[model samples]
Target: MSEPAAEAAAPAADNKKKKWLMIGLIGGGVLLIVLSVVLAVVLSHGKSKKGQSKAHDTEQQAEEGDAEGGGEEHADAEEHGKKEEGHEKPKAEHGSAEPEHTTETHKPAEGGKPGDEAALKAEADQLKQDIAKLQHEMDQQTEMLTLSDEAAKLKSEINALKEKKASLEGDKQKLAEGVKQIRSGEKKCAISGNPDKRLDELRACLGMSQHGESKPGEHKPAGDSHEVHWSYNGENGPEFWAKLKPEWKVCAEGRTQSPINLVGKFGSGVPALSYEYKSSALTVVNNGHTIQANVAEGGGVVLDGKRYKLLQFHFHTPSEEQINGRANDMVAHLVHKSEDGKLLVIGVLLNRGKDNPVLKPVFDNMPGKASEEKAVPNAGFDANRLLPASRNYFHYDGSLTTPPCSEGVKWFVLKNVGNISPKQYDAYTQLYPYNARPVQAVNGRAIVEN
Candidate 1:
């Protein structure tokens, strides 16, 4: 019994020992696998922590960059606002609000989660692009404004140039018209061939006479009552006299007119003049042109054996005739007419000297109103006292000094000038300041000294 029992116990003990060993080995492998799994989980958690730390750093860097860029952009916008304040106030206001918008955008980035960093970065990039676009648009608008200002200045300059060119054209036209008038006068004088006869024909063509009536078959009807009105200044002055009537064209177009300069060599075969005067009734009249005194029609002068009766006499200030390129203070023209309707004028130049009793009656009783005639009763005036001591004279064939400036009149200007008181000269000048016409061109006309 002892042997059998010992063998069975030994086998069962061995089996139990083997089973426990296997269980122990299996438990050891399970423990190793659990430890490995715990280590892997710890490593993964550490790597995740490291990655989150890196992403946080990058987000912080991006936020700082965005803040710096926004600050710089806001500063630039503020500066631009100040620069554009004058011309564009609306743009200035828009630029001034940029700093506020940048501040609001940066507020969200300070408390943002690490997970939202990429979205914040993407938004910042888009905002930067928008800012860049706005800047580019503002720059373009500024350039456009500058160009517009320059264009306005150029337009103003162009307008000024146009105005100056127009003024120059007007002046050129006036000069051309004046030249044409001068050429026409010269042509007419050349075609006539006779200077003295041409003057008469011009006067006849102009329909001008001393009595203010048109000649027959020249212009308006002989019975026409239309009177040509003129004045010393204003629209009806000498500058516009030619345009007043068709017959008075020669006043502006005549080449050989009166009141010429007595310069150059004298001509030969000059006729002498002899004056025979007598006392006559003095009738003064203000004929709207000058103070004229009418004689009794008996006074006469002998010129080349032709007797011409003195009809009237008138005075002029700053004498119409220039003697030796100089003018006297005043002059007296004694008008005379021959039987054949020919005219002759004796000009007596007067200067400031002793008071002349010969002209006292004409000045003291002068008429006041235009076209008014007044006869001084018992006012005896002798024509001889009006002449100088010397009878030497310069003669020329010219036209009347007044419009219509009739021509073909024989003029005798005394070489020895007479004398008149300052009071007498002033009496005539008070009424008409400048009644004499501008001196006409000589046009190669002959002047004689006798």
Candidate 2:
């Protein structure tokens, strides 16, 4: 019994054991398959890593080749620069032999690295701009210096011109003074061309009156030039005239002037006055000094048997002949000249009581304009009636009573003076009112009473 049961059970047990063995084997095979697949993936990854490392080596080789090629190109460029430099030297040598070099060593050149070339060109432009500014500044300074020099030169010229102008002004002032002196002398000559006046049978060609100052008849002196003219004013005035001019002795040396007094009583022993009328035409001249009427072409009067020419006639107020120690109203002097030019004077007194017809012609036509000539009426006039009927007189040697006081005048004053009205005295006083000279000393000269 136990054997059969044991055999069946063993088979069953063996089946069970077989079943466990199969499951274990299947799990081991799956594990083995997974391990093989993992091993195969690792092997494939190792091969891929080897291939990438080779590719990296190839890329490094290519970079090395490019570097070598760039170095060779740089060498070729350097070699070409040396060759060009050598050629330039030979060319420069040839060019220099001909006195010129087309290529220069230090010449400005182009074509370099762009950045470097541009930077150099900018530096050169900056230098050129700076040089131009410096040049402009220098030119301005030179122009300023030139202008300063020109201004200095102009100032010197202006100073010289001012000096010349001042010299010319001084010369002009001297010329004007000289001309003024010449004009003054011309005015004086125009006043000296008139004749003197007297009454009687005598006359003087050149006549002057006796004053305290200048000499009479100075112009009549012989050998005197025309410029030796007599002056009644200035240094040639009456009192000091002889000191200025030597020929004016009549003023300093002469003693007497006309208008004397007849003091003595009338007597029978009086000498008769001789008179002769012998002139034809007469010329009346109205000078600023006095009125004078001159007889033309030798008219004369005979006194003391001597024929004296009637030269001129003039007037004076208040008769020069003092009757009873007193002068009459007016008197006329008839100046006469002898054949030798000696002078004589006959004085006639006029009264104012009645209008005397004898003096009418002379008063009617008196020359009014200065330096003008007039014709006196040649009507009949009796020179004898001018004397007093008693014929009493006083004789003295005197001078003419004017600016140039001339001596050697023979004066005959009547003792008796006729009466003249106040109207007749006024008529003569209206013209030359103060013509009478003051009485002078007789100076021991004889005074005869007729």
Candidate 3:
């Protein structure tokens, strides 16, 4: 039993096993076919995945390469820009490849972008150059201003110095003039005392008394009247005055001329006549022609030890004293009275030059207008030089020489004459070139010459 059963069982089992194997095989085949299909799909999928991975890798690599290339391109562009900017030349960059865009934001290098940094540097350089130029201009302006101020200061200083020098020069000239005037005064004082010595001293001190030594040749009388008309430099001019004035007859008759040519005339052998003078009270009178200084009662004149009372002194132009018929420039008539009331006149001649010490006081005291009177204060006028040195004289009985000529005047004219300067002559001539009367016939008078 066992064998048959075992054999059947075994065969059934083998058949079952075979069937199971076939099922398994079929399943395995199906699984294999599915597996094969799945494998194929998987393989395909795997292959596709591998291909996608490879594609992804390739894409990543290409992205990396693009990134690297973009970086290099950017560097090249920057380099080209720098080169162009250095030369101040314009350049353009065009990217045909698509740009590698990045989300990350960045700033420019230090100051700005490449071009911007270049522009900023240029602007900084321009600012520096502008500042330097402006500073230089400001320095030039400051220097110019300083120079102008210095020039103005120097000019002002120079002007001030010039003014000071001018003032000092003026003062110096004034002082010199004052000293010269003092010297002239001393000389005049030394000459005033003695008649004989004074005459020679005066001749030595003064120049020629007359423009011409003698009066010009007399011309026939045209007419005579109070309103007589005369030409300045024609016939009957100032030169021939002796022919025109009766009171001026002594002009031709006198031995010595007034305004005497005194220089070199004095000699060591000549002795001066002695005389003295003192201050006296003075009264003043105004006439139509000039003012007169009247000697007061206390005043006296002593001549040769003869005492006389001084009356008055009057002025005249073209003085009565004459040298070879030449009249003096000006004269003063000093009237004196003897103890017996006899009248005596002393004549003093005057000429012009630098101001005369003796004449300045008299002229200063003179009344300006005709008929205007003024009293002299501290009267101190010298009368020693008033008379002619030569006592020898022409004696005649005549009238007053002025207007309303009175008769019965005892005229004693000394032969010697006095001197004056040419300026004084011009001054007197300016006042009255011809103020005297025509010469008269001597009327049987005794004429004398020294």
How are the candidates ranked when ordered by lDDT, highest leading? Answer: 1, 2, 3
Best candidate (score: TM-score):
1
* Clashes per model (N, Cα, C within 3 A): 0, 31, 17
Every model's Cα RMSD, please? 24.7, 40.9, 34.9
Residue 190 lDDT, candidate 3, scale 0-100:
38
User: How accurate locally is residue 307 in candidate 3, as Cα lDDT from 0 to 100?
Assistant: 68
Query: Which 10 consecutive residues of model 1 have the lowest summed lDDT?
Result: 55-64
Q: In model 3, where is the ten-residue run with the lowest total lDDT?
A: 214-223
Shift in Å, residue 50, candidate 3: 99
lDDT of 1 by residue, 1-450 (tens): 599999989999999999997787667556654654564455334444334332111111111122433553232232211111134432222111222111111122234545467778999999999999999999999999999989976875664454445434433453455446557774232236687665445434332332335332112111222456565565567778789888778888887788888987898788878888888888776655678887764378998899888887888778888977888888889888888888888899899998989888788877665544567756677788889888888888887776677788898888988888888878877875567666789999888887
TM-score of candidate 2 against the unseen true structure? 0.43
Work out candidate 3's RMSD over C-alphas: 34.9
**Whose lDDT is higher: candidate 2's or candidate 3's?**
2
Per-model TM-score versus the true fold? 0.51, 0.43, 0.35
Model 3 scores a TM of 0.35
